[model samples]
Target: MTTLNALHQLDLDHHIHPFTNLAGHQSRGPLLIDHGDGPFVVDAQDNRYFECVSGLWSAGLGFSEHRLADVAYAQMKRLPYYHSFTHKAHSPGIELAAKLVELTPETLNHVFYTNSGSEAVDTAVKMVWYVNNALGRRGKKTFLARRLGYHGSTVASGSLTGLARVHDDFDLPAIPVRHLTTPNYGKEARPNETEVEFTTRLGQEMQELISHEGAGTIAAFIGEPVMGAGGVLPPPVGYWTMVQRICKEHDILLVLDEVITGFGRMGRMFGLEYYGITPDILVLSKQLTSSYQSLGAVIVSDELHDVLVRQSAQHGSFGHGFTNTGHPVATAVALETLRIIETEDLVANAEARGAQLRAGLTLLEDHAAVLSSRGAGFLGAVELVPDGPAGAAGLKAFEIAHKHGLILRAVGDALVFCPPLISSEAQIDQMLAALRLVLDDCA
Candidate 1:
């Protein structure tokens, strides 16, 4: 990207954007961002907009976090790149791994690095299979996932993802996996059903799925602690408790994909703490480095780690990894990012500001188009009364928000909001005001 013209031209000629309507992109072009400060992003023409969704729900420290930038710069100058394979190690990788083990849940003392959430999940899948195989339960190769859960786009991780768009025309679930009903009580619950009943019903469905596939064949159950791309849907009451019990009963490993809810986004160090559920594998990314660097980690429990070691020793190597796995510069940035999150007490801030954000969304419930609000911690969404096709209203609101100097993404008919954890009460109010303007403009 030499200049604005050259960048746009290059995008037009070569860059195919992800999750975008290709035909629409041809005409609409790109919303080129010039720079950012705190939780706000400025467009090329100096149009300032609150980054409501935090750049795909990744940039928790917003765009201009100097500490992360400085660390990355210094690391690059010293030792830019190194691999964790073949017994080779770097200080950044070693120190960051220890720090992660200290921060993550107990028993999950092992860290495996990947470049993205998808790869981390892919690694997790392989780990599950390997563990079962090591124990001579080769038939336990199937995975359990939730419908509408967003995991990632890689072959293995995409298979775990239950979104229709991800599987559309892609012939996915290419792996051995079973998807249960989405635990979206607001949308999926029977009329007059209690939240507890809805949760029990979902639990039954899981049991039925496991039964149909045979318990010995189901290796793992994967889900987001609070579903992210499925329209900011939080778990129903008793959902996690029921899910964990069933997984333990069946000897199946539980995996939590906390790509969006990790770090301080959930107002806790990790989502497991919020839900009081322990996972055998914790998939982390996004806010891990606050998206300052593309670093991901799959934290494994001690029990599973022992199996991995025995199996790998038998095979002479794990035979799975990436070239950029635990890249020094990325690890350095992630270390600093975690340090800042601790010292600044961003998790507490998220809890406080998240209350404000949720209240703001509830106030918007009085809007003609808004049906209701849903969220926890720093994540929230407003379900709109669809005008025509599903999600059309959300897309409209998303576009109209720009006119009010706000940038938020719409998930289906649910307009989602996930501001940086560093956002203040004033910024939250400003975001709400802009969103109210968008809703009014829609009317």
Candidate 2:
């Protein structure tokens, strides 16, 4: 076995991690994760810690699920490689597509495959534009997104993403998109604004933006059901209702980027279902295969799919997709992943465990370091009363959390948590206890 020192040196010499500060990593080195056991990840030194963010908000079944591995092994042996391009097709891809359409709303009856959530978002953008062009609405190319809503890191998708970190030096939003205010009551609400009033104002802002941008020029409005990367901000009351009404009122396509909230993260199969609103396009990834394989799907309404059909007929093929658009093994794993989610009823587990988590975070609100707590289902966040700068307290708590045997993601002063759907009540208690100790140290 390679020594930890040797491994660390090799990683430092070669690896370029995403969404990490390269300069800091060079000085601090990597926390080499050797393996995963249930909801816990084991470091190279055999130290175990709860992966609270579920490996970037994926990993619905946690790590080390042998069933997924077994399915992958079997699928590899049967048909390790195949692509869904041209006129050729494979059973796994076809079956998975069928399953997705079945799971989605009746209006969204078609599925397009991609390799990642970013790619799925990009695909959705292209599909929406293609549909508009087919319908001869060439001017409808602008997209409306939220300031903090996270879409993906690809060109078009990253443009949909509203984070400065994701945009800095990246020269993104390569597509024409408008960003609105984040629907965060904690951070954006007025001094004396009530929740209902905040929601009303936000809804009005969307309507006003549509009018200002000219509804005929807007292609779609995309957002996360619960803004995950943007500090786990759930929409204010009546926000989705208003967004849906405006989209329908102006014939703008509604796109829900459910990559983080899909497949039981929000205690439902999809975030749209959790929020009780329908979208013309639903983007999915991350938990699609429990992150065992890289795969994503863009499910579009039947109306849009018909436009795609007509456009493709004129354009010769859709003129979109990846080399591994519908890789056989990835699709096979997704099918098995969905089966496990249903068989184990992990959605219900998320709801029950989420209740416990929310209650625990609510208790933490009394802590001197904590200003407030909020979340939905298994997604939660606790904003700290930072003693120093804007993000100092949150960063300190994240570092201290490691010592307490926990891993949490920080978006500024907000420490967000997303434990695996399979995490137990005991594990949840352990996580909360570790968090309490970490908070005490931060305080």
Candidate 3:
């Protein structure tokens, strides 16, 4: 039998963790999560922790959701696996696509499935290029992203992502892409500048970049309505509006990466609705199946969909798909996940709980080690005062919070929070209480 130490040794020898420093991981070891309940998880040693990060900003239905488990089992028994390729289709996949179309904005009516957000992003890039080629716009191949934006980690998607870590040493940005300024008013906006002024400046900056690159060469501008993994920064007012207008004027497509903010994280069915901005392509994952299963989708606009259809008719076929393009089991789980989100009204719950969380964190703005607090909906972050370097203080705070029975993430000094959508008012209070104790102890 595998003892705990044996399991640890096995992991240390074989496991290659993502987004981790390998040497440091070998030294520190892994946190073995044995089980979970509601919004909390228990380690192998029976240590319980409030899941403040919602399992990498997914798991909206929380841990131990039997509904999702049962659905998976039922689907497995009925039709465990099937492929949607060569004009073949399945009910779960077809129904899920229809449901997503119904839930999203009107123009976004077509859904293309992938197994993860990374693949969805890559697919969106390919679709943009394909549509441009179909329109005889061969020169429009460049992609515009923002300095801190995160799309995914695939070769092309990583190129679209603007974070340096996603690029460093990977020799990425393998494609022709340019990154613009992040619309983080708290960090980037100048002193005494109004929100309008900031928005205009960023818009002008984007326009300038477009002009520098020649608008004919740029294919699309991809961004997150609420930039996640980049410190949970919410867009400033008028940011998305100006960006959308710019895309229209330049004839560049607008691709919103909703991998982190989709499925009711932003107090709306979609983050685009929350900001009142539309997009040409919508990349989705993470919460689509509430992370119960691996599934993703790229929802395209009617205009682009028509172009792709024409392209396919002109050529022999579209020539793009995966082995599990719309795996029956994954889609079935996603269908049930959507039902739960809608039936439970978790979107509204996120709004209410987000308000409570923001209020509680705002009170910490005066703390000696806290720099500021900012968030929207159930997603939020508290920037810690840098002790010496940027991540130093935040790292300490994160360790303290863990000791206080909370699981939190520190992206540099900005500690991000994304609790499950099903969290009760009392659970939210408990999260805040844990944070308070950690802050006091650290202070």
Candidate 4:
């Protein structure tokens, strides 16, 4: 056997892949990746596949950017690791923090580093409790998240996540986190309800929850600006505006989880910008380093930062930080990534290409198997209904597309596509062609 085959066999025997069926994977073996070039990743057998999901919706700059590699090399030569605890810091971390404050929503000014989105979300949850403790509101501890919202996979963050599979067999949701309705028009909207009325009803349901739970006892309301892992569902018109107003009126902290929607994924630098809402605390990851490295950030508003500072001074140090927090290599890579996004105008590109993607995917809506197509910028999903004995056609479409040199993801019965921001119009067309073939094959 070749080295690649040997490696795959070893991996199948030794590794436990995340979110995968272990026994099935053992039978099939892993798709051992050897290299990548410009939106395409090659397996050990030299078979190339278009990475439609952006390698878990994180590789916004694509896979073969030498600039990112150079940044990592330079940072590793200088300082590879560092902790951001007890006022200790490094140059790359400090500079990246400054850039984040400048680039994020104006209300957000403080940046807390974490190793991943899960850690960032867990940190946000702790901060909510800490802030309430500082303010002497001991009763404010419960958190409210939307039913389809995906925050992270850590204990607290996973509890905040509303996906059922993430909770099954994990004994998760260890904390008191309430889940509300997801605003998926196809799945949840009533026959007579307009999008506007649906949004209003959801907002009212939130208001009712606040009243029932006692506003004094609720700490924060966490949600993605556009539900990504829940199947890339964007909010209805005026949905976030109403949600923000309700949160403010109830004095509940609004925590926007932008792990998947941040860094130009939603045609803007942040989903909050797309939705026109100013959150008090924001969770960011994924596209921050563009999967070049593992890094996450919890951005706090000036108000929350002030409160945290005061509380820390009174009690002691903040007393929370990860060992790899503000890792120099990751920070340097992220800094260069952001610079590339700005210099290359990738955000604008995502907006333009996103329109083309949406337009192309919209054509699929006429297909008998397709139920709906929803997207914002490059992130999108096509919901499929059961056609014949295949059950969920979208899932079969995903597998078919994968075999046809395209890697797509299926969330429930929906096929999700989140291509890189650097993707060209031709690449978008190629993706659509592959998708069309898959859909036709499925039919």
Q: Over the stretch 141-242, how does candidate 3's per-residue lDDT look in tens digits?
A: 999999889988999999988888899999998999999998899989999998889999999899998898899999999999999999999988889889
* Candidate 3 residue-wise lDDT at 397: 87
Candidate 2's residue-wise lDDT over 1-443, tens digit each? 88889999998999998988899999999999989999999998888989999988999799899999998999999999987788889999999999998888889888889999999999999988889988999999999999988998988999999988888889987899999999998889999999999999988898898888898899999999999999999988888998898889999999999899999988888888877889999999999999999999999888888889988999788898788999999999999999999999999999999999999999999999999999998899999997688898888988989888998899899999999999999999999999999999998
**All candidates: CA RMSD (Å):** 1.0, 1.0, 0.9, 1.5
What is each predicted model's overall lDDT from 0 to 1? 0.92, 0.91, 0.92, 0.89
Candidate 1 has which clashing residue pairs, if any?
A: none
Off by over 4 Å in 3: none
Task: Score residue 84 of candidate 1 by CA lDDT.
Answer: 80
lDDT value, residue 213 of candidate 3: 85
Clashing residue pairs for model 4? none
Error of 4 at 7 (Å): 1.9
Q: How many angstroms is residue 198 displaced in model 1 relative to the true structure, after the best TM-score fit?
A: 0.7
Q: Write the per-residue lDDT of candidate 1 for residues 1-443, one digit (tens) a residue.
A: 39887888778789899999988998888889999999999998799999999998999888999989999999999999888889999999999999999998778899999999999999999999989999999999999998999899988899999988898889897899888889899999999999999999999999998888899899999999999998899999999999999999999999999999999888888888999989999999998888889989999999999999999999999989999999999999999989989999999999999889999999999999899998998899999989799889988998999999999899889998889989998989988988888999887
For candidate 1, give the lDDT of residue 71.
Answer: 94
